[model samples]
Target: MDGQLPIDTRPWPVRRDAALHDQTMQQTIGVVTKRLANAKVTAYAAYPEANHWRQRAVEVKRQSIRQLEEHLATFTQQVESHGGKVHRATTAADAIQTILEVAQHHQVRSVIKTKSMVTEELELNRALENAGIAVRETDLGEYIIQLAHEKPSHILAPALHKNREQIHALFDQDALVYHTEPPASEDIVALTQYARRRLREEFLAADMGVTGGNFLVAETGTVVLITNEGNADMVTTLPRLLVSVVGVEKIVADWSGLIDVIQQPALSGVGQRLSSYTTLVSGTRGPDQWEGPDEWHVVLLDNGRTQLKDTPFEDVLSCIRCGACLNVCPVFRQVGGHAYGSVYPGPIGIVETPLLTNFEVLPELPSALCTLCHACGEACPMNIDLPGHIVQLRQMKQERHMNAIGVTRSYRWWARFWATPHGYRRSMRWARWGQWWFVRHGRIQSAPGLAGGWFKTRDMPPVASMTFHEWWDRTRGKRQ
Candidate 1:
């Protein structure tokens, strides 16, 4: 939101290069993801009931999506009954337009926001700024990136890439506006205090506030904003007019459904048993509440999600945005979020983006990026079957003639060899003799010619002289 930081609107190639070159991004993502992944493993070990909870969560989300229309109607009526306005948007453009109209109608000039992936997906900050309104991000992580003019490298920790020194420098650059020089100390507490002080003023001064909802409880028409830092609370409570932008798929059938699916993953994803602040706002605050917002608006953005319902990919909707999958993904751990060339990243992005955009632009992600470990699928509370979706995407690419030349040829060879057991055995026999040149101490050190590149970083095992089936047959005959 700061005007000083450089804007990065370049195409995917340029953006990817920038992200890759960011050493800070690399180190931050590595440390954070590793730590969180380990913590989750420990937490699950402590709670042997996690598998049971996961199943219940998946069922709740499935049922919610099945009865989505009914739930949405009920939600709308509940919100309206409590003096809140609900606006439905069919696309990103429509959602942006609706928000702009609401801001203009309220005569709002400056806005404060909490971290919301949905808002990031819509690029609402850019849209509002272009309309000549100033916006400030209240969440600490979001505020740091807002200053840097960079996209989030991770969902839970948006500015996870920044260290103390870098953050100190960023604060120094913007300190003049707060009427104080940046503190000399690089301690965590000092930096946090400085950011809190600066953001608190913006919270009080802003005419409008915007946040993303974690879950929309259809039974009560309540919007839940879960946070550890309490920034979301300020964003929703202080401003006169508060608007919440939520993806339509975030809806749950009832409060009970939310209890079953939404809270645990959100908590575990961040290494916390529960967030410090869990505020539920059903409608505009009444006069009896001494300090609270007066007007409320909930903008439900469909943004291509309706088409995904009832399909295999509909399970993606069950994601609570806890970011568990991002922490465990090997590809995401290495390249970070920006490499995905989308607001959403990791296994979820690879599957969701193509489906949401209808594959208009081919994503640069490779099928090889996935080791087919199914780790992400296990981590997902919704049991989205992420590996299954990735395989489906690969099939789609093959059908469209977009698969790489080498991959297509490899698959063709595999199909031929698999069609006949005799042919496969004959090929294996030839391969064993052909591999002798590369064999050293029972391992293939490197292959000759084109195949050498595959062994550059790995040692391939030498092929056995006899096939498994042949050995088994000979052993059985001798025993008889």
Candidate 2:
């Protein structure tokens, strides 16, 4: 475990190319994503008025964002009134720094963590390990991936990239050290039980527990956590210091919106009406209270999120991290989440990457990455116009002078040629002539230059010898 390498943060194209060729990863991602997509469809089918509920959920988030400052102030005051501290983090570094300060203040030696994409974004686990603090992941999926030294491929199902055989192997290796004899069976429940027994010790020993906030209620200043594994509840309850480090965009005006919030993610992930656990906490355990954290900290992270408020990408903030966008995404279906080489992946990730990260470090990703199929937007329970955000980013990339001149020129020329009959016919003639050499069995399987590279991976439709109009007119003449 000491020699386990950190996650590879290579460029998207590099990771994408690798994902394209990795047969095992391809198979796992295809099966898991398909299963999730089918389940979500079936779930949505059962509820005829799902779209109506989604709209109301969108409105709740819209109203909260509109009065963000006021609500934030109210939430902050409420948290303090109940004895919890609110820390505002302006950036990823700021969030990590704040957590480190808290850890040092409490003399924390060990921390138990539940699944949190926000903390992953902050790279908090690595930071803690580097500082000689023992950090353990309590969520079963997270624990498996942590032992494997991998980042989550799916938001809800963190270990979606691994098969049962792989998980059995990982767990067997773990049990070998603890048990008198090696485990015999490859059952999922057995693996989960072993993991639970191991993590129980970590939970008791942990001085602090950190998890992500699903919905921060402005009216009550409550941090709402929804999870299936029940590890988050244990992590928050057992540890003396509990920290909810989450994105500020996760705010809603109050608890009234929770049903829609919980319902949307439930339909997408497990296709249930709601998740197994929905826990809301406003403050530490009081003298009147029984068992809870002695101290509560809610660190609200901005980190380029607040910048999206006035921008064209504002609707993206309404996302509940339901991950419905990933299941239906054509690209994600093939390459999986790791291919994006970022914490956020799939349609919404393509939109947020440039805005949240330094584009100079990453190539201005082609909007072609999205396939423009609009499946993501259709699946979104929040009614986030997801595909629209990708289009807006594509336009922004061009305006920022990030697009290559040759590619831009070629697209402009093609658009002009496509607009008129004469030009279209002339272009078709040229394309047919160019494609004649490559066409095999009525499809272009191979070509020269960029088209060759593209066709190497996918088949292209061969140009027709005659235009549709020309064929139709000839047939009409014969009929007459």
For each candidate in the order shown, give its overall lDDT on alpha carbons: 0.81, 0.81
lDDT of 2 by residue, 385-471 (tens): 888877877887888878788778877888999899899888888888888788888889898644566886798888766678779
* Residue 178 displacement (Å), model 1: 4.4
- Counting clashing residue pairs in each candidate, in order, gives 0, 0
What count of clashes does model 1 give?
0
Stretches > 4 Å off in candidate 1: 1-23, 47-54, 176-179, 366-368, 425-456, 459-480
For candidate 2, give the lDDT of residue 378: 88
Clashing residue pairs found in predicted model 1:
none
lDDT of 1 by residue, 293-386 (tens): 7889999988878888877788888777778888999878777887777677788877777777776543444353567778898787677889
